[model samples]
Target: MFVKISHLYAENFPQLTAPFRPIWGPKASILLVDDKLAAQLNLSPDEILAALQSDDVAEKTVAMLYAGHQFGQFNPRMGDGRAALLGEVSGQNGMMFDLHLKGSGATPYARGGDGKAGLGPVLREFLMARAMAALDVPTTGSLAVIETGEQIWRDVPQPGPVPGAILVRSAASHLRVGHVQYIATMGDDALLSRFIEYVLNRHNMRADAHENMALSLLQNVMERQAALIAKWMSIGFVHGVMNTDNMTLSGETIDYGPCAFLDEYNPASVFSSIDRRGRYAYGQQPAIGGWNLARLAEAMLSIIDDNVETAIEKAQSVLSGYTALYDAAWRDLFAQKIGLFEVHKDDGDLIKELLTLLAKHRVDFTQFFAELGPIFLGEKKRDADNFAAGHFGMDLAVWYEWKNAWQSRRDLESMDEIRILDVMRRANPLRIARNHHVEAAINAYIYKGDDGPFKALYAALSNPFEQREEWDIFDAPPQMNSPPFQSFCGT
Candidate 1:
């Protein structure tokens, strides 16, 4: 029983409305579905499938209107061109979740583009979103993927049209900062107020005073975003397109377009083909995150206070706190990565030094941290030596010096070695959704119509922290001489 949740967004802002159009040649064959999430939502696989396949579902769906700042430029109108909010489901935990369908069909905001998705991008989002969840990063979860049995043209380096698919993406809420910004730009104070109240109630956030509701919401979103971005940085995840529209107010990592995990520890790594200027690089994520939050703050100004000067000051104060919140989160996570139970003044410096060394030597980001667990636990000296030699090559002397300094700090902490090693094991994942492996899987599925690689990669990434013999190959980085890998927005 899918309950329509009052259609609060559409009811509040009728001007920003569009109806969902049915998928062309809709053949809903399930490619991937999350049984775990299904159970959480109290829906069986068959029931979920039945509901999705129902003809009425398309008619009931709504495509939302919004705007975004793309590549530091504001586009005043960009909405769900190819996606639709099917309906909302109340989870077992009493939390409200939205089931949005990507590649559903055409919407009013299609803007001359086909309202469809390629199989590769759908599979990529499913894999990457689940992998992020396993790594304890807050992210939207894929409920199911249904192959549409249609071909969609894409601008991939390859020549032909690719197979189309629809991804059932579940999120705490699909509302974005851009949505609020859109309402604010309309100059409709009543609609903006209703939207803010809807968000606060939906997210279960409370405000002490009516006058402070917007400021309170802004504070909550900022704190969650700070912690969320820190989690992404700790795991080497680059949200390649950090546009305001892509930044979900629910604090979960949303869109997977052009997103990738770092292989070699270069802060300036750019995977998104469209990011020619490297605006959303790995290291720049925090700064970009702050910039997005500033946009949110700007949108909330009128709601925060009636006086323009007062509202700007209030927003500025909150925006200024983002740096401290981000820095503290980064420090704590980096500390955990290095197996430090307690923070020391020099811990930040030590962490920076290690990252500097990794960057200089071009070490694999996942492997470097994963290998450290065994070395710190004294399980494999030979492997540790080989890893050191492999990473440092002729520069073993400096590597050894850094290793010695790190060990000295560990020793000085007097923390139980077993406890420290346990933290390290949990902090360092043995496998990530590696770009090369993901590409190989996509290639297998797209060209050969084989899903073996896709399934295997999903299984390996499902439990990335575990050391499993079957997944050992997934841990290795791609060959150094392999062709440079690039990702696209899959639009």
Candidate 2:
């Protein structure tokens, strides 16, 4: 194995070091290993298993120290409690990727809690990460899910204990805004400078043209995050936790805790069990994204320039660009979703009105877009009609009006119906990892030891855009009277 242990953060800031303790159990059955990533790394299943079981590898693992603003309050110290960075591996493309293990026992940052993960959350992240990738979303990739053959206590309604598991997550880098914030809070200018340089090199960010390296890095992160949040909004994905620690500087969606796709199109939908005030709700994500980036800007201000006042001014100036960038990306994405080849000023209003209608009728967001595929194709009126009735009930007058207006706008582009339908199909997915379905799969697996439901969901979500009759069951949302669904952080 051509493995390289960078440990850049640890080497620079020895104060953040934490030893990795091996997790002992009777079994470590590999649930899902990403073969594509394995091939890229020239690793076989046996090799991965060997690496997981090796105590030497565990000895080399390091837990990082960081701090973040959780629910708008700053925590001076927060770090990997149950996770540790094993090492880095250079892929065939020469890009370095971090192999991080979650549920790998306790570290110094465990904070009086057992450093363990439940099987349900591990499987959820594995499925959710793959599903997001299929939808063309940038996110951390799950390399594997290994059952630990142990049980952990959680707040789920179920009795006894939940099965434990470990998630092998791969990412470009585990660097987050909070990591910089931690260094900044420590008042270590030298450490911050080294950290900034490390990040620039890791992400291949050029700072020569910019007046300051900190400013350059901040701009790069801002633009990437703006576009990322836009993509999330377009697909109705609510990242339940938007803490500073959860925001990756690499622009990929990092944590999967309490994250979920929207079923009913409510602007105020919040799935994270801890977010009682809806600070990270669906409609609030973009703003929260900007806020998180601002925190990053604050952390880098000292390094942005020696003059504190000038640095503040420059950082705010860069921060001001976030809204405009986010708006443009959001508009462009919604335009594509609505089958608009070219965007006009009125297109925003049209999209907003449609969203208002969706929220008013409590329609399933994914189904609404997916049903539009057939409507644009002009192939299945009966299916479309059923969807309308199911979604809009007895009154669909507003829906018809919106449809007429949308068709008129689409027609003005003079594109073939086939081309428009193709665009719609690509923009909309027929299958999503719905909360209810995820819960059902978890229940089945934990209660009955049956992987049938989980496997079926995995297969359907793997090809989200494809239309297949067998996947119809995965298309629908949970019943209206079904027990209210809530997602947990599983920490």
Candidate 3:
């Protein structure tokens, strides 16, 4: 079996990459393979493993270079510490996707840490990324997970040296906002110009080179980020670490470390243990998204306009547009979630009230919306009773009051009940990567040497929009535990 791997990015941008080789274990083995994604990449699991172990491919492997602001502080030197770009694979659609190997080995940017990933984090990303893909969110897809047959140290439950593994990540491109920031700080306008052109051509984004090339690039990036973030928020996802480097130019969700979905409807939720001050809190994601984009605007100020003042003005104007862009996307998505097929200006208040009630009553975020469509269609009497018993607890009056108002709002829509329910079922997911369930699945794989739990959850999440009685367990929230849920970077 032959695989056509090309070094397009490394060959085109030599200055942005360092030639490298992946250090593999003595007994590396494939653990999980996404068959659909494998087909898209035009390769089998065996061919992927063969390519990763091939000396000919290792000679062309490279670790990308960039700079980023990690948690509000600028780090001038950062890159793929434990990952290697094997190169690009052209999908069946003729579009090129980068096939990068994570947990491969140390690069020049290792910064004094082992270039290895634990089995737990490897499985977490595999499940999380696939769930996001099934939900139709723009995210980096996982092709396979390879158990490296080595033990690596990590600070997780049942912590000791844990089994090491590698993930094959596929994406539209590996370019990040930090990549642009890297060239912007090199004190070479020609180099930055070339980098910008490379991104534009790679992603096929149109920008007039003669007039304000960087400004045009900024607009394109803002549009993509707006839609991406909107989808994430609608699904209650927190990227945990929204550093400039993690904000990909392609707008796909990359780097799922410390990431978790919402359980209750609390806006102040913070899962990443390192997020001490709540900078990337659930409610703050939208604002933080704009802040990250501001950093990109700062990096592109040079080529945005010849005049510094004009550049600043143009960037600010575009930055101001983020609020409207995000708001529109958010509103449309939320409206559909509640069966508002024809959105009205007052729908904002209705949506706000529902969130307020959920937060106030401590209701399960995913479950509530999942049941709303059926409940609205005069079905799921048991779901209504369960809702009251689980949260409201003998006080159905408040719940019914809000439901009455929402139903009144829906009455205004011209679409019939069936069509309205169709809109809602599509908008609201039947399942999410809930925090406790994810932990249990990880524990099953790491502790019990059992992949059963992980496989069951992955299969349930694959059809996230459909209702299956047996998968009801997947939709349930975690029981009350001693400590609050805290996710790790798993570095």
TM-score-sorted candidate list, best first: 3, 1, 2
Per-residue lDDT of 137-203 in model 3, one digit per residue for the tens? 9999998999888888876654689988999899999899999889888877888888888888788
Clash list (residue pairs), candidate 1: none
Q: Residues 70-142, candidate 1, lDDT per residue (tens digit)?
A: 9999988989998887767778898888888888777889898888889889999999988998999999989
Worst 10 residues of 3 by lDDT: 376-385
**Evaluation by TM-score, superior candidate among 2 and 3:** 3
Candidate 1 local Cα displacement, residue 77, angstroms: 1.2
Candidate 2, residue 110: lDDT: 92
Give stretches of model 2 more than 4 Å off: 1-15, 157-159, 381-387
Q: Which candidate tops lDDT?
A: 3
Compared with the true structure, all predictions reach lDDT values of 0.85, 0.85, 0.87
> Candidate 2 at 3: error in angstroms?
5.8
Across 134-240, the per-residue lDDT of candidate 2 in tens digits comes to 88998888888898888888765454588889998888888899899998998988888888888888888776636888888888898889999999999999999
Query: Candidate 1, which ten residues in sequence have the lowest lDDT sum?
Result: 2-11
Off by over 4 Å in 3: 208-211, 381-390, 393-398
Question: How do all models score by TM-score?
Answer: 0.96, 0.95, 0.96
